[model samples]
Target: MKTLQKITVILTIGLALSILVVFFTTSNAVSSGNETIIRFGHGAAESNERHLAVMKFKELVEEKSEGKMKVQVYPNEQLGSEAEMIESVTFNDLQMVAASAFSQYDQRISVFELPYLFDTYEQAWQVLDGEIGQEVAEPLLEDGLRVVAYFENGFRHVTSNKPIEEPEDLSGLKIRTPEFPLSISTFKAFGSNPTPMAFGELYMALQQGTVDAQENPIANTYASKFNEIQDYLSLTAHQYMPLPVAISEEFWRTLTSEEQEIIKSSASEAAQFHRDILRENEEEMISKLQDAGMTVIEPDRDKFREEADAVYEAYKNRFGEDFVNNILKAVK
Candidate 1:
C-alpha cells in the first residue's frame, strides 16, 4: 500500500508541475478569446542591436495590448531578404519588416542616401523626425507600406584589402555595392567599378575574390565577421542608412485606432532604444575589430565628401533640381 501511495504522490506532483509550466509559458500571452498575430521580420542577427530593439517592441506590444496583439519576431532573414520580406508585407504574407532599402518602394527616398547628407547624427535625426521624414514615408504609404519609425544602420564605412585614404585610393577597385542605383552611382563617382551584389552573397564573394572589397557600418561589418577577410576598415562615413520599421497597410487597416497607436508608439520607443544602444557600443565595436587584426584607417573624409558632390549632382538631374535643393535646405 505504501509503494502504491508513493507512486500516486509522484504522479500528483508531476501533474501539478505540468500545470504550472503551461501557465508560466503562456503567462505573457494575451488572455483574450480573439487575438491578433503580427509577424515582424528583419535581416539582422539575434546579437545585433536591431534584433534587441525588435524584441523590446515585442515585449511592449504584448504588455500594452494585454495579449490582444501577439508579435512574432523573426531575425536573420527567417522570412526573407529585406526586399522579399517587404514584398510579402505588401501582399499580406508578412505583417512587418525592418528594412534599410525602402528606397526600392519609392525612388525618391534614395535622395536621403546621398553621401554626407547630414554632417552628424543629431542633424540627421532632426531632419528625419521632422517634415522630411513624412515626405520620405508618404510615398511608401501610397505603395502599401506604413513606416512607424526610422531605425539606424549607422554611418557606412569602407572595408577593403588595401588602405583607402582618398577617392583615388578606391580607383580601379571593384567594390560590392547594394543593387540600389544611387549606391552604384555614388561608388561610380568615387572611381570604383561598383558591382551590384546582395548582402548575403558578400562574404563568399570576398573570400573567393569575386569582389575586392565592400562597405558597411562598423557594427554590421563586425557582426557579419567581414573583419576576418578584410584588411582595412577605412572610416568613410559615406552614407547614413536608416532601417524603416514598416507594416503592411492592409494589416494596419484591420487594426483599431487604439491598437494602431499602441503599435506605433511601441515602434517609436524601440527605435529610440536601438539608437541609444548603437551610440553606446560603437567605440567597443571598433576596438573589437582592431583586436581581431583588421587595421582601422581614418581617411580624409573631406576628400570623400568632395567626391560625393558628383553623386548629388547626379541626383539633381535624376530627381528635379528644385526637389533636391529643398532637401538640401531642410537639413540646413
Candidate 2:
C-alpha cells in the first residue's frame, strides 16, 4: 500500500539523520562556532626554554589549524603545583600540561633519574625515543595521561653556598631537591640532607636559608638566577630530566583526528627546538653563570659516580634488578 511505503521511507530518513547527528557530535568536539580551545599549563619561568618552545607550539598549532584551535598557556605555577595540574588533567579540567614531575606519578619513571645513568644527551635520547621510553610512559595511560612529546630539561648540576668538590664537601649540608624519591635517595647516598621542595619556592628558600643548596640544569640555574643567592655551581650532571608534553586522554578523545595530528606534530617539533636550544647554549649558559659571579666547579666525577652505586642498590630490586642495566645497555 502507498501508506506503508511512505512510513518506511520516513523511518529510513529519520534514522539516517540521527546517525549523522551522532557522528558529527562525536567526530568534532568544538564549541558553538566550531572553535576548539586547549588549556595548557606548566610550572617553568617565562624565560625558560620550555616556555619558549611552548610559545612556538602555540604558534604552530594555530597556524596549522588556521585559527580553528587555540592554546592558552599558563606558566610559573599559575595553574597550581605540578601535582595539582596533573590531577586536573585526569579529571578533564585541564587539556594539557608539560609534566616534569614524573617520579611523583610513577616510580618506574624515576629509574631514568638515577645518578650517573646518562653520560651524554645522545645516550639519553636513544633510550627515550626508543622502546624504553614508550614502556615507561605506558603505565600513566591507565591514569588518563597521554604523552605526545618529550621536552628536554637537560642534565642537573649542583649549586651551593660553598664549593662542592666531593660528597664530603656536601656532608651535612641541606640540599633542596624536588619531591622526587630518587633525587632524595641519591643526595642521601652522597651524605647530604635532602630537603624536598617545589621549584617555584626555591629562590626565597635559599635567600632565607631554608635550604643550603639545590641542583638543576644549567639553563634552569641561569633562568632562576641561582647565582644571585648561591655562590657555587658544581657540574654534577646527576640526573637528566626530560619532561613530557602530557594531554588529558579525555580531552584528546574530543579532538578531531586532524586536530590531534596537528597538536602532536606541533608538540614534537617544538620540543625538538627546545632540546636544540639547550644543547647549543650549554656552554654559553655556564659562562654566563660564572660571569654572574657564581664560581663554577667540576668535581672529580669518578668519586661521585662511585657514590651513585648506593642509589642503584636502593631502587634496583624495586624496579626489577635488570631494569636499570637493560636501559643502560640499550643506550650503549
Candidate 3:
C-alpha cells in the first residue's frame, strides 16, 4: 500500500513538470511568432537619397520594435516602376513606397508641381511639415495609402544638348518630362514641346536623340549620368519637387497604435536625414557634372517665373483661387 502511494506521488510530480515545460515553450513561441515584416519599394538606385531614406527607416524601425518588426527595401525598381509599386502598396502587396509621383493619385498634390512655388527650401518645408501637407495628403487615405512624411527632390534644373539662356531658347524643342500635368504645363508655358515619358526610358531617349532636353534635380542628373548625353545644365529652378513617404493603409490598419506611431516618427527622422545628405552633395554634384563637360548656366530665374504666370493662372482656375491661395499663404 505504501509503495502504491509513492508511485502515485511520483507520477503527479512528473505530470506537473511536464506541464511547466509545455507552458514555457508555448510562451516563448508566442513571443517570437508575433514578429511582423514590412516590404518597401522605390524606383531610385541604391545611391539615391530615396533609397538611403528607406535604409535608414529600416534600421530605426527594427531597433525601436526590438526585433518585433523587419523592413525589406527594394531599390532600382526591383519590385516595379513607381506607379506599379504604389498600386501594390495600395493593395497591400507592398508595405511602403517613396513616391515622387503621388500627384497622379490626387490632383490636389499637383499644387507641389506649380512652377516657382517656393522661394527657398526652408519655405517649402514650412508648408510641407505643417497643416498644408496634411491637407494635401488627406485624399490619399481614401485610396488605401497614407503619407508619413515629405521628402525633398530639391530644385529641378534643365539639361540639354543646347544652351538655354532664356525661356525662349526652349521654343519648339522636344523636351522630356515626367507624366505630371503641372510639369507639362510649366514646360509648355516656357515654349518647349513637352513629351511625358517614364524615368527609366529617359537615358535611352536622350542618347538616341528622341528628346532634346530633360529637367531634374542636380543629384538625379549627376547620378543618372545625363551629363554624358547632355551638353548644358540650365538652372531653371522651375519647380521644387516634393516626394512623399507613403504606406499601405490596409497594412496600417493591422498595426497597433504604438507600431503606427513608431513608423511615423521613424519616417520623419529618415526624411530629415535624406534632405541633409542631398543638400550637402548638391554643390559637389554640380561640380561633377561640369567636370564631365557639361556647361552649367544659371538662367535668369525671374524671367522664367514671369513666363510661367499663365500656368499659375490656370491652376487657380482649375483648383479654385481659394485652394491656390491656401498653399501660397502657408509659405509665409
Each prediction's Cα RMSD? 8.5, 9.0, 10.1
TM-score of each: 0.88, 0.87, 0.88
TM-score leader: 3
List model 2 lDDT by residue over 157-238, tens digit each: 9999889998899899999998888888889989999999878789999999999999998988888888999999999888
Give lDDT tens digits, candidate 1, residues 146-242.
8888888878889999999999999999999888887788899999999988888999999999999998887889888999899999999999887
Please identify which of the two predictions, 2 or 3, would achieve the higher lDDT against the true structure: 3
Model 2, C-alpha of 123: deviation from truth (Å): 1.6
Q: What is the lDDT of every predicted structure here? A: 0.87, 0.86, 0.88
Clashes of 2: 0
Q: Order the candidates by lDDT, highest first — what do you get?
A: 3, 1, 2
* Position 46, candidate 1: lDDT: 93
lDDT of 3 at 169: 97
Q: Which predicted model would earn the best lDDT? A: 3
Reference-based TM-score, model 2: 0.87
Instruction: Point out the worst 10-residue segment of candidate 2 by lDDT.
Output: 23-32
Per-residue accuracy of model 3 over 139-189 as CA lDDT, tens digit each: 999999899998778889999988998999999999999888899999999
